[model samples]
Target: MGLTELLFVKMTGGNPILQGLLGGIVITLMNTFGALVVLVWHKPSERFLDASLGFAAGVMLTASFTSLILPGIERGGFIPTFIGIILGALALDLADHLIPHSHAVLGYEGLAQTRLRAVWLFIIAITIHNMPEGLAVGVGFGSGDLPNALKLMLAIGIQNIPEGLAVSVSALSAGLGAHFYACFVGVRAGLVEIPLALLGAWAVHIAQPILPYAMGFAAGAMLYVISDEIVPETHRKGHERWATFGTILGVMVMLYLDVALG
Candidate 1:
């Protein structure tokens, strides 16, 4: 058999590298298609959108905590994992604070003048966020723990779809070029994952000792996202109750999936 065939067989047998690639693809496609659908059906309501975004955030936060951080602690011991998590959160927090996140345009003059700039800013933030997300997925798959990795990937993918829609819908509400812009942003987020996955795979191979730290680091970054972006956005309209419910539901969903898959 040829090299391609050999690789294919390995993949079919549940290779970590293949799993990571598949996971990345799954997330990318979901974001792209989901955004497209949202663009096609445009209905903007602040309360509804906030609640939905909250739900997505909840799903992502739960997965990051349970699947990634906990596993890292279990494998790498408490002190190291805790340090890693702190460092990770600090790093992302620093980046988030330093980086000027783009907000959707409001007001007619603001919309007309800063539309493109806002779109680009949004894209950049999403890209930065997605890169780490992809890395996390890759790390999960590359760990040689197939079942958990697959479950995490599936969960993340599901969450990403709504995220895509949220971005798309938000842009549309701003009266910018929603469809094309959303597609571009969504695809960009997913593509950012590929390089991160490769890098994560290499890190795993080179520094086995740092693997848990890396996972913790990712969890920290995700936690930042949940706290800063997801929570605030979700409660934009005082739908705290719905957001809380969504978060609980998200945690339950991920837990159920983890159990069922395991």
Candidate 2:
């Protein structure tokens, strides 16, 4: 069989990878749908946006530890998981230095800051934030643990709603695009995950041993983003108190879901 046919079969034949991709896509779209409020109604307040960002970050942090890292250690072992986490964090750190992106409140970041347009900068920021989410979902499925994968997917999906709002608002505030168009931009940020999910699934399915490492890597990547990017963005404004409360709520919600569903 051709490689294309084999992939088609794998994806269509009840592959967890397919499930992860579909879940990611649906949630990502939901995120953009959240952004529609700006077009259909009004823009969210900065305080509200800060709180939402904190909430998403909290959700991601919980998922990384509970859903990704723990399972990774169980499947592979401490050494592999640890190595994967270090590598993952390093990879994102390098990207942060090399890629030019803007924070919602911090203006611009990264070393290669040329005269790029605000739209591209916004896109870069979104890419930095959303790429790890896709990886986590893919790695969750790749670990050969369907229940945890579903839990991770649902957790990420729920948080993506607020993330979408944050991204759309950031893009609009940066003057990247208009109403519905801005929402489209926010949605486009997550489109990179389809291929990423496929890659994660194929990798782990082919080499099952790497599943744990991959999971750890995904977790690390997400942690880096949450700590370095999302948290900073949330706290950069004066709404740190509200953001902290939002983060606590997010953690509680995810913990409840994990316990209830798991």
Candidate 3:
């Protein structure tokens, strides 16, 4: 099958597991689409990247509460949800120390001068950052909440566009390859989400007890990424105004989606 066909095949929202897989594929495709934009722009403006990343940050920030934490508290109660949030944040914090994390602007953090090429390291770091997002989408589906899952998927997929473009531009800037191949790697980086999403759905399906915790955990992880990675990177550039504006716009869009869809 062609690349597009391969990725787009057999998406259904019937089974929660399948639905989770569908969510992963959808986000991946969105990222791919964004990366493809590099074909047109050749070199995306840093100001625009900062703004778009800011928008992504906003989406994840609001989504953490609107789609995850709030519903978690409603279903699982405050104590469990609160504890789950803390655990989630702690887990990501621990991961942050070992491997590097990446942003479009700031590049990799905590990366040592290892044998691994910076390009590979950058891809690995971005994949790590994306894991929680995949898990969040999966948990949303696993909760057996159709509307919530779909909304979560839509939000993530929408945000993935800019994220994907960022990866593509970064890869090209790193001289990873020609534009097509750079975007190819961008698609490859996002492929990590597929398996993680599946794992999330399976875990939630088998245990079911972890749904509330999963929700809280996913939300917490996303919030951590926002505070730790996205915000810092976006603000570091001289484009803080654009970043802030984009963030506010993203928040508004997500809130509207949550209200309109939920």
Candidate 4:
């Protein structure tokens, strides 16, 4: 398909790249705001962190299906989406093998230990966790469906708040300064999203045939993060009950947003 046809959204002024950039910015800002939540909730308990992470997992769980997988099926058929999902999961799994990183609770994983400090390893984990989110937003915008894009954007941004809070809180638990470092993390997170957003938009520009696969890929990556990291980490603490409820609430919120936005 032609570039013009690929980006033909009459409602949003028909600029997928710009829309994709904005989508990335909105989610990044949401994450930044999430990080800043540390100021108010200062010294939030580990129990709270578990619940928040669970909440993030819930949002992602639903978002993976509603915003990515289902639409991908509708637009491009099930086979491509299924293949995309498998490929996406494998890609992240491969990253896990190739890149060593440490989680706040799960501790160190990936390639054998290097000189990376605990803080840096921790940052690596978060970065790897966040890349899919950026990719999802970019693909949503790239889909040329403004309503779905905005809905996905809102859900992802909301979920990000908890993630950002979890990150900043973890930083503080490690005795890192909250403002400078947290904000720095937020900026770094944005850097991860913006260019990737452009890339997603641009990728679709080159070939519409890949759109379904792209959407499925994003969904699968998110599903992997939720299952492998967020859920397990949240349950490791003593707050499993609260964390479960948090996930329920998060799922409800995303569901509400999906209905409301549409």
- Give me the candidate number with maximum lDDT: 3
Q: Residue 20 CA error for candidate 2 (Å)?
A: 3.0
What clash count does candidate 3 reach? Answer: 0
Better of 1 and 3 by lDDT: 3
Predicted candidate 4 versus true structure: per-residue lDDT over 1-262, tens digit per residue: 3343344444347787778887888888888888887777777889888888888888999999999999999999999999999999998998877898888788888999878777778788888899899899889888888778878888888988888888887776765565667656645654577777778877775688999999999999999988888888888878999899989988998999888767
Q: What is the C-alpha RMSD of each candidate to the true structure, in Å?
A: 4.9, 4.8, 4.4, 4.0
**Tens digits of per-residue lDDT for model 3, 1-262:** 3332234333452577887888888888888898888888898798999899999999999999999999999988988888889988988888877776444567666645567777777787788778899999889877877677778888999999999898899888777889999988788889888887888877888888888898889988898889888888788879999999999999999999999885
Please give the lDDT score for candidate 3. 0.84
Q: Between the candidate structures 1 and 4, which one is better when assessed by lDDT?
A: 4
Against the reference, the lDDT scores of all candidates come to 0.71, 0.80, 0.84, 0.83
Scored by Cα lDDT, where does model 1 land? 0.71
Clashing pairs in 2: none
Question: Taking the tens digit of each residue's C-alpha lDDT, what string does model 1 give over 1-262?
Answer: 4453345347656555666776777777777776776656666566666666677777788788778888998889888778877887788777666665565532122123343566666766666567667788878877766666777777888777777777777766656574787566666656777767666655764577887888887777778778866787676567887878777777778888878776
Candidate 1 vs 3: which has more TM-score: 3
Residue 257 miss distance in model 4 (angstroms) = 1.2
Tens digit of lDDT per residue, candidate 2, span 1-262? 4453345346657576676666566566666676665676557899998998889988998999899888888887999999989989999999888898877687788876679887888888888878888888777776667667777877988898888877888878877767777888887887776667667767787789888889889989999998888888888879999899889988998899889776
Error of 4 at 135 (Å): 0.3
TM-score of each: 0.85, 0.91, 0.91, 0.91
